[model samples]
Target: MRVALFTTCLADTLYPNTLRATVRLLERLGCEVAFPEEQTCCGQMHYNTGYREHARSLARRHNEVFHGYQAVIAPSGSCVGMVSELYPGLAGTPAPTYELTEFLVDVLEVTDVGAYFPHRVTYHPTCHSLRMLGVGTRPHQLLAAVRGLDLIPLPESESCCGFGGTFALKNADTSTAMLADKMRQVLGTGAEVVSAGDNSCLMHIGGGLSRLHSGVRPVHLAEILASTEEDPWLPETR
Candidate 1:
């Protein structure tokens, strides 16, 4: 199957490592993956910010670039959710798209990932993805299958990380308040790293951990799944 990688603007510029990890993981799974350069932002940022026209143009561009691929997989729940659910609403058009884990478990049907990380980890599901995409427990299926990885379920796995695109800017105070609770939930788990598909949320959560001098770090799901015990950095037991 020909799969296209929909690396969003944030993942493309702010968190390039996540996109690279995605490419590495998919290639190892024996699927042919291609990067479509024309694809940029899924217009989620604009759409979520009340800019319908700009979002429409972005949605159109995204669909035009992604149409024929067997599946378009992205490393972000936010962007994938935008393309799959929100884009259709904005542009009155829909196309096949998969958040990385969804594609891995549903399409690829293998979760061993051929990579191992000995870290005790937790997953944070961004709001749009947890509800809009209705991908309940499927992402966890892949996380649980990784060899040597102890996947601890978060207490409120469905809570938002509070990075609602421009919601951060418009209501910074509210955003931080929400983030505080999310960070607390993550810390409560005592996991070394918190993993999630959307870097925007991880970016917010990671900043909180840094400000508090907490030991926990926020990592993208792609990064964790692409790692292996060969690094020797992984804790021997966790």
Candidate 2:
């Protein structure tokens, strides 16, 4: 099947390798993936920020660029949720977008991943995964199936990482406060690596840990699942 890669704005700007790993992993699995140059922002910012008219134009742009693909896959659960859930609420149409993990598990339907990573790992279920998409254990269902993973449980796994895009700006104080609790949980776990479906949240939480010189690292869900013991890049902070 032909897949279009929606790297999402944050991933393109900060976590470029995450998408690279995603593309590489897909190719390894014998799937064709394309990056649509005409694709830009998914218009989630404008809509979330209350600029409905502009958001509509941007959404129209996204659909126009992505319409031909048999399937569209994005690296961020937040972006996927915005496109799948919010886009319909706003535009009254179907886009058939999938979060990377959701796509891997739901559409691809293979758990072994033909990949491996020998690391102590923990997953932070992003808000879109928990509430918007109600993905439940579908992500976990995939992660646990990796060949050599030592998955650890995150305390209060449902809590937010405090990076709700503009929410971080509109309520910086509250955002940091919430993030503090998440960091506390991550450290409390003693896991070597933390992973999530959303890079924006990872950036917010990972930035805090970096400032404190914490050894724990943050990674995207795709990068973790993409790792094969033979070709491991295990999402360490770079």
Candidate 3:
């Protein structure tokens, strides 16, 4: 498939490796991936923060940038949800959009992309991916198929990670409370690393973990899925 990558703003700016890993994983799976350089934020932040007009404007741009692709894929569940579920109402029609994991498991129909990560990793399902996109169990299925991965069940795996884009800024106290509880659950799993499809959530949870000086680190799902025995992310490096 000729896939156009919509590397979300967060991944592009703060987590470039996740974007790179998504590209690498798709390429390894025999996909002809193209980077739509004109693609920018999916206007999720604007839409969620009562800036409908701005978001609609961005939605138009999003449609234009990814106009002719067979599929528009992104590593962010929230961004994908905004495009696939919400964009049509804002703009006229959106390009066919798929979250990276969803495209991998559903479109490509492959769980084991030859990934090997020998570490205890627990997955946190972001709200948009789980509730909005309905990407249920696909991520776990893929994680289970990894060669040396130890996929542990995260406590309250389906709960929100408190990174609802502008929701955090609007309700900082509530957001912090939710994040605190999430950090507790992540640490409870005793996993060396926590992985999720959305970097925004990881960034929020990871900030709390960092402040607490916890040993566990946050990793993007694509980075873990992209890992191979020949090019493994060593435990010590994290």
Candidate 4:
């Protein structure tokens, strides 16, 4: 199947490896992935911030850029939620959008994409993926199939990491408190890494982990799924 990659702004800017891993994993699964350079932000920031007109403009551009693809896939559930859930109201028709795990499990019909990551990893279901996209068990299914990966259950895994785009900045105190709770849960798991579908949430959680000088690392689901024994994903320095 041929698909267009909607590399969300956060992944493109801060976590290019996640995008690269997404492409690699898809190509390994016999997919022809294309990156439409004309693709831009999904205007989620604008829309969530109450700039509906600006969001609509970008939504139209998003549809225009990726109109012809059989499927539109993104690594971040946050942006996918924006496209699939809000785009209909913002733009005329919402693009056929699916979060990476959703496309892999539902559309592609494969869980084990021949990945290996020998580490204790816990998954955090971001608000958008859980509440908005309802991407439950899709991520878990894929992770369970991964060779050498010890998937530990995160305590209160569905709780928000307090990074609701602008929510972190606007409600800094509340965000930090929530993040502190999240960090405590992550540390309790004794997992070496915390994984999630959205980098924005990972960034927020990672910041707390780093400040605490905790050895735990935040990793994207795409990166974990993309890893193979021959070409393994090296852990980032804390």
Best by TM-score: 4
The list of candidate 3 runs beyond 4 A from truth reads 234-238
| Whole-model Cα lDDT of every candidate shown, in order | 0.81, 0.84, 0.89, 0.93
lDDT digits (tens) for residues 50-131 of candidate 4: 8999999999999899887899999989999999988888787755789999999999999989999999999999999999
Query: What's the C-alpha lDDT at position 83 in model 4?
Result: 95
- Deviation (Å) of 135 in candidate 4: 0.6
- Writing each residue's lDDT as its tens digit, candidate 3 over 100-214 gives 8899889999988899998999999999899999999999999999988888898888888887878898889999999999999999999999999999999999889989999
lDDT of 2 by residue, 1-238 (tens): 8899998999898899899889988888778998889998888888888899888887788888888788898888788887888777666664578877777778888766776777888999999878988778877887898877889999998988888999999999999999999999999999888889888999999999888788888988788878887788744445
RMSD of each: 3.3, 1.5, 1.6, 1.1
Stretch of 10 with least lDDT, candidate 1: 229-238
How well is each residue in 1-238 modelled by candidate 1, as lDDT tens digits? 7788888888887887788788888887887989988877888778777888998998888888887888888887777888887776777665578988788877788767876778899999878778777777776877887777888889887877777889988989999999999988988998988988788888899989989999897888888788766632231121
Between candidates 1 and 2, name the one with more favorable lDDT.
Answer: 2
Which should have the higher TM-score, number 1 or number 2? 2
Inter-residue clash pairs, candidate 1: none
